[model samples]
Target: MSDYKAFRVELKDKIAHVAINRPDKFNAMNADFWTEIVDIFRWVDETDEVRVVVLSGVGKHFSAGIDLGMLAAGTHKYGKDVGRNAELQRRVILKLQGSINAVDNCRKPVLAAIQGYCLGGGIDLITACDMRYATVDAQLSIREVDMGLAADIGTLQRLPRIIGDGLARELAYTARTINGEEARSIGLVNRTYADHDALQAGVLEIAQEIAGKSPIAVRGTKRMLDYMRDHSIDDGLEYIATWNAAMLQSEDLRIAMTAFMNKQKPEFAD
Candidate 1:
């Protein structure tokens, strides 16, 4: 894998740990962040060795969101023509959305380990993950309204589904910050730890547990859950029926069954 300017990626055992590396800048998302994340997640998607991903940040905060300097510089390039400027801006927003979608659409499940500040674009990033765990003191916010724009990335779309529309709307409109305890109460995060160390340990334990499962089964479960979001219950049932008809034939199933009968741990092939 290539060196990443915005992230530090390490694969150990079957888990891929992707950490935002810009601690000095509060792990702010710059131009490199937008492009490099897509590259990283793409690698994760294609690599059979990688069974799951744990996304976090180096240093005290998860991320303070997009770099203000980069945001301002992007706007400075707009031309005098109103129509052209709007079109250019629209493309930029779409590209940003695609970056977040990389995490959302990755075949393997992603678990976010959040601490400190998770605001603005950070909110977008974590919302895209399959599960989230945070430090009890982690400060999270839907901060786009304060910046004079709607969150154009995944937060506005995904947050509502995770936390429910009423609370999501309140957060977006108020641009208020909530601690991890409140986040857990509202189902924004699955669990909360007392500190960052405990948070990392807890999330890693979960990731390792998931990595021990059959990769094919885990991927298929994620696929089904994502499909269920935009589909009817009947559609989900039919889709999974069609899906398992083929997947049920994998050797992993036989191995799992045999292991169960013998009271042994099943080790699945990648």
Candidate 2:
């Protein structure tokens, strides 16, 4: 596995765990974080030994949003001239978007395990994942508005599709914090465990289960599902037909069939 300054990555039993490791800063996103996250997800896509990824934070909170210190230092797109500065900021926004898109476009599934705070950019991070689980006491917010900014990352785009447009708009406009139970009730998270330990255990169990599946099938399923989110029903069906035409020819299918017939487990190759 690649060494990451902002994240702790561990691969075991075909499941990769990626935890935000900046507890001293409440895991806030900084320059190193933006750079490293893209690298981490790209590595996940390239590595055949990994099947699923569980994303979490190291301390009591998931993330407190982008580091204000970075902004004060003018680390992001900033220029002295207005015209050039606007262009520079636009470029920076696209770069940040691409960084989060790496997680969304990853071939394998990503499951987010949230504990305390998941605000602003943290929401962007989790909304990009395939699924999200949280501790009951966790707090979440779409907090960019409070900072006089629209969330340019994945949250505004992906969250509306996950929850509904009305609720998404309400959260974006009001910048209100919601507890984990409300997050789950509104379909932001799949489930809310009693505490952080339970959240980690639950998400890890699910990740392990996903890893146990044929990697080809698991990856194809994620691809098709992501496709269906934007395409029409007819378009999705046609696409899946084309997809399975190639995918069905895999040896994993034969192994799966034989395993079912023999009532035994099947070992699939990468």
TM-score of each: 0.99, 0.97
Q: Write the per-residue lDDT of candidate 2 for residues 159-263, one digit (tens) a residue.
A: 999999999999999999999999999999999999888999999999988888899999899999999888999999999899999999999999999999999
Q: How would you encode candidate 1's per-residue C-alpha lDDT over 146-263 as one tens digit per residue?
A: 9998889989899989989999999999999999999999999999999999999999999999999999899999999999999999999999999999999999899999999999
Query: Model 1 residue 33 lDDT?
Result: 99
Model 1 alpha-carbon drift over 4 Å, by segment: none
What TM-score would candidate 2 get against the native?
A: 0.97
Model 1 sits at a Cα RMSD from the real structure of: 0.6
lDDT of each model, Cα atoms only?
Answer: 0.96, 0.92
What are the clashing pairs of model 1? none
Tell me, by TM-score, which candidate is best. 1
